[model samples]
Target: MPHKRRVYFISDRTGLTVEALGSSLITQFDIVEFQRITLPFIDTVDKAREALAEVNQAHIDTGQRPLVFSSIVDDAVRAEINKANGLVLDVFERFIVPLESELGQKSLHLLGKSHSAGNVKDYNHRIEAINYTLSHDDGVTHRALDEADIILVGVSRSGKTPTCLYMAMQFGIKAANYPLIPEDLEANRIPPSLLPHKAKVWGLSITPDRLHQIRKERRPDSTYAALDNCRYEVAAAEKLMRQTGIPFLDSTTKSIEEIATHMLHEAHLVRRVY
Candidate 1:
């Protein structure tokens, strides 16, 4: 059996950065199985002490010291967690000290500064992008389609909706997605409404086996979920996209984030939010 270990992401606020860092690092060691646990908002000495206890308890239970990735800003609170019976990696202590020396200045020790909510413009832009994406989903309406940074076209369950929403949420992109029904595939052409905005149009195609599996979950024992129908639809959709000069990606092996980021890069869409 692979070595089993516990990993903790400790932070002063949302713990997103800490989790991202720790998760990325642990992925390098595929031979071991890591059980991740996040303990966020550790801003006080009491909270830090509680966190330390949890880490210690994990060590006792697993007979292995947990890996702690922390970004606590409060010195007193950090001191409490420093006694954890694990390999504690301090995020701020590692980078901020070197950065301060290089710049010859003291760094801000404020809590949750990285995820500060003071940027009103960014918040507003994110909201607008989400709203726009929701309204334009599944070709609900063509209104303001010209404002979209990128548009994804694919057959049903080909992974269009989630990719568009991810782009809008993560990058503040006004993304819109449309589904290619049987009629469009039969005609062997792109949707008429999308032609006017072909410059920003992209496509997503999925493997027939994967598409069949996905559709079967949503609709069982139906033509839509049949392997033969899935194969036909995917082939026809790819053919239509190729004939219309639209670039597409095989979404079978890609995650939502990968699909969204790929579209953003290929389309050269400006990220409206940081």
Candidate 2:
């Protein structure tokens, strides 16, 4: 078994920034295994010391020093964290000074600034987008189809719903998705309702084997889950998308994040939320 190293993500606020940054770097070291824990809202010296104790305990237990990735803005709290018996990677200290020097100004060094809900307008936009996505899911309604920033057309379980949801939550884009049913596939055309907004439509297709596996997990032994049906649906859906000149992606191997980001990039859609 590979030895698992301990990693701590520490922050003064939600700890999301530190966790994301640390996790991204950790993923680069595929050969090494990591056990990560996040300690959020460590705003006081006492809390920082408490977190340091946890780090120290992990190091003692594992006979290896834990790597600490911290995003604490307060100097005193951050200083306390530095006393841990591990190598500390300070996220703010890593770039803030050089950024300040380049911009010829000092940083405000405020806590929770990275992801705070200070911008009520942007926050509201994200919430509204999420609501819109939920309502329009699975072609539930076409009343406000024009309001959608992007619409996804795909076979069932081809990864439309999650991709739409992620785009709404992360980028604040109002996404709507519709599944290609047997009628639409046999007709070899997108739904009539979707055709009106074809300019904003994107497609997601999966390989026959992948679609079969996914469907079998949902409704085993049914025709919907059968390999032969999955093959027919995939081929017909791809052909429909191609004939309509709607750009499509193979979602079999792509992560939801990758698909959403790729759609945003290809369509040149602006991100309303960061």
Candidate 3:
């Protein structure tokens, strides 16, 4: 068994960047098991001291030095955190000096610049996109198809709703999703309402076994969840998408992030939020 180590992601803001970077790097070393903790909004010297105490305590408890990944921009706060009984990896200190040398200028050393609170316009755009996606879910309305950045067409539970919401919340993309119902599958044609916006339509397909497993959880012992029915619907949906020349992706193997990103890339949709 691999020895477990305590890990800390410390930042002056939400600590999202530190957590993401640390988690990604830690995953490369499969031999070590990591216990992760995030200390966000550690901008002040007092907060930094508190974080240091926690890190030290973890190291004492585990008898191993806790790995600290810090994105704290403040010099005083970063200095205090460095007093902890662990290896402190300061992201800004490590990169900013080199960047300053290359650019022949010093960095602003600002806090919360990456995901700042002052960006009201971008925040509002994300909220609007999320609202639009919620209201337009499952072909509930074709009234505003023209306003959608992209339209996702898929059979039920083929991972449409979550992908649309993720795109809206994360990228400020007005995503709309519609289900390919039994009638549509049987007809082997795209819905008439989607015909005008066919150019923006993307299809999501999944393996029958996976779809069957998902459906069974919602409607146990029903024909809707049967493996044979799932196979038929998927095949019909794929054929319809091919005949109409619409781009499609399999959702069985892709995460929600991957699905949303792939659709954005394929559809050439501009992200309003960074």
Candidate 4:
């Protein structure tokens, strides 16, 4: 087996951009293992220096030259990073330099400017969608019943949380999820809270053996994570979804991006890319 090089993704703004670009970058190097460390909104020069020192320490400790993939927007901030010991790859510097040359104009760096803000209606729609998502997030399991644009129900570790978060983040969709508890299974009825929202309910199903393997890692030796239990919950939950006329997706072999995209397409929801 070939050894995987450790690559660190650093950002002094929202780490979302760094993560998104890094995922694309890693696809080009299929054999390399990636270790991600996100440093978001370290905007000041002092903070930038501290961040660079830390990166150098990590490179020395690991005895490996770490690849720094960054999107530090401020020129002074980026300058501090370039002084570090390891190899640094700056996305803005790489792209902007060539664009400046081609356009035959000096490129001015403006760090905090946003070009587009949608109309009032679109702005209100996003605000409402975000409010719904936050109010129905993972902690308040029951609120998912009332406010979701779509409710995804499944057995534990069937990828409920990640799918819901992705829908909210990628699209401006307010997504909620519920785990099919043992009591709900025994009753053989979809929870009453979800009945009124039947039209918007969605389901996710996973193979029992695969779910069992996933759960085992979390709470090993418990019957809750057993193969038999997973099979029963999955079968019952899926049946409930279908019987209630809820449309669903099998999340067994799909990546998080693929699953979110499929659901968005099926639901006719538009992705509000930032």
Model 3 lDDT tens row, 66-119: 999999888999999999899999898899999999999989988767743578
lDDT of 1 by residue, 58-162 (tens): 999888999999998888998988899999998988888999999999988887555337888888888899999999999999889889988999999989899
lDDT of 4 by residue, 119-196 (tens): 666567667776776667543657545656787777778887888877776677888776767777778776677778
Report, for every candidate in turn, its global Cα lDDT versus the true structure. Answer: 0.91, 0.92, 0.91, 0.77
lDDT of 2 at 202: 97
Model 4 CA deviation exceeding 4 Å by range: 1-6, 27-64, 79-86, 97-108, 113-147, 178-197, 214-224, 239-245, 253-258
> Best by TM-score, which number?
2
Superposed Cα deviation of residue 140, candidate 1 (Å): 0.5
For all candidates, the clash counts are 0, 0, 0, 1
Between candidates 1 and 3, the one scoring higher on lDDT is 3
Model 1 residue 40 CA deviation in Å = 0.4
Better-scoring candidate (lDDT), 2 or 3: 2
The RMSD (Cα, Å) of candidate 4 is 5.3
Clashing pairs in 1: none
Deviation from native of the Cα of residue 84 in model 3, angstroms: 2.5
